[model samples]
Target: MTELIAATGSPSWDMSRTREMVRARWGDKALEALRPVLRAVTTRLIHARIHFQDYQRLVSEHLRQPLEAGTPWWELMWVDEEKGIGASNYFFIAAEGYVYAGVQAQHAIADNLAHVLYYSLGWNVDQRIPLGKVSLGTVCAQLARETTNSPELAPIQQALDALSTAPAYQALADVTNHIKHHGGLPVRVGWGTSEQTPFEVLLSAFSRKQQTQPPREIAAFLEETYDAMSRAVVTTGLALNEWLESSVAPAPPDNSLHQDSTPGGQELHPTDQPARV
Candidate 1:
């Protein structure tokens, strides 16, 4: 049986079948328009993984040293870029850029996906399906509503439902929004023990604080974001392709639209499945 993969859970896609169905059902231009959007975002997500890995390594080096009052903690950063204050900050900013780009790419995916979906559903190219300012859950509900009563559309609906309810998808959206509208991810500054002034240690002594320095950190969140975006490409494409297949496989009567697109559904938490890149 063909499994409906969760959004953010990568799955193997039959590219030839997917292409044929989209061309036949939604027209050649439909796939043409959508590919570039997915390509742009997916490409960025792929490279972001590398940058995150390097950044994580850089952060890890600093974490190995003990944060003592007289030790050469972050003060050695100039000679050593990995554990140095300047280098860590630079990597953090670089990592932030990748995370922020993923967020932008998601918006691009949603807007472009809506355009392709609306046009395929018989709406004019000029008449776009509004997807701006709406959550991923909202978009899924609207699409599922558009496909109600047509069992042929059930696959697409199930995919949408899965997207609506998946925690990773939700977290993906939340992270994207937070980064875009809320400045960006908080990569807090960690103090170097060697750089710590005597007065700073004195204050720590009075408070009886063992937590004198910031926690050891990595850009794990950004790496996760990178993975999430990469997975979304496959999962979302699967949904679109399955819907297209259903549309073309069915007779005219079965494919006719009887209901207007509206948003409504109880989001279901999707079970785990095999993951792919």
Candidate 2:
């Protein structure tokens, strides 16, 4: 399964397969106990990947406008330039939103999974972890401490460590924080000479910090980030599955903690069979 997922070059999860593994090792109660949070993580994961794909598609399809060598930064235009003033602005603005939302969703996946781990370990509300905030770094730090003493959680810790150290993780966090706390992040689309294509359509962030640096293409960066997130997702899923296989039955879920988090018409329940991306 791991080899197949890697070969596809895209992240995929088998929700029903996970449920069957849980049911066979533990019972139906454990399956139900974990379903809600798993579904929430799934929601964020899918959305993040989908947003990235959409951004790539939109940019690739519309980056056909021709520009000369001396074209001004403000003059190099997106596809909708013929429409009027501010019409082309929508193109870049929408692309910015896609990247922002995609990064934010990737960050949320960690929190949703942290919630899963928090309950799986039977930590009570008296525990001082700030589960409500949007700090992946903070939640992951607490998880590190909790998992350090238990050899059973070693695999989970490895996944967390990989995610925390991933270049994409920190880069996305910086961009997310800059947008949320500092100020606006403007998206710039420009043309440059390239060996592969006549027009190298560059999508990049604009801020005071980046102003001193040369504008570089971000396609590789975004692709790297997405691949890193995919690896984390795959590793985390396998770790959880293995842990469930060796563990005792989990306690029944507190009904109050189970909320309706499923989006895109998907249900929170998982079946005996494996699912596809």
Compare the candidates by lDDT and give the number of the best one: 2
Mark the 10 consecutive residues where model 1 has the least summed lDDT: 199-208
lDDT of 2 at 126: 46
* TM accuracy, model 2: 0.68
- The TM-score values for the models, in the order shown, are 0.56, 0.68
lDDT for 144 (candidate 1): 69
Error of 1 at 18 (Å): 2.3
List per-prediction Cα lDDT, in the order shown: 0.45, 0.58
Choose the strongest candidate by TM-score. 2
**Candidate 2: global Cα-lDDT?**
0.58
> What are the per-residue Cα lDDT tens digits for candidate 1 across 145-228?
666765665655565565545555555555555556646655444453353321111000111122222221334344344444
Tens digit of per-residue lDDT, candidate 2, span 1-277: 1122244334444545455555455445655765777666766656766787777766655554323344343444633446444656666788778877877786767667666655454442445564465245665676678677767878877887788888677776666666688654666765456735545434454454554333435565556665666567667766766776567455533334434333422222221111123
The alpha-carbon deviation from the true structure for residue 230 of candidate 1, after best TM-score superposition, in angstroms, is: 4.4
Error of 1 at 214 (Å): 15
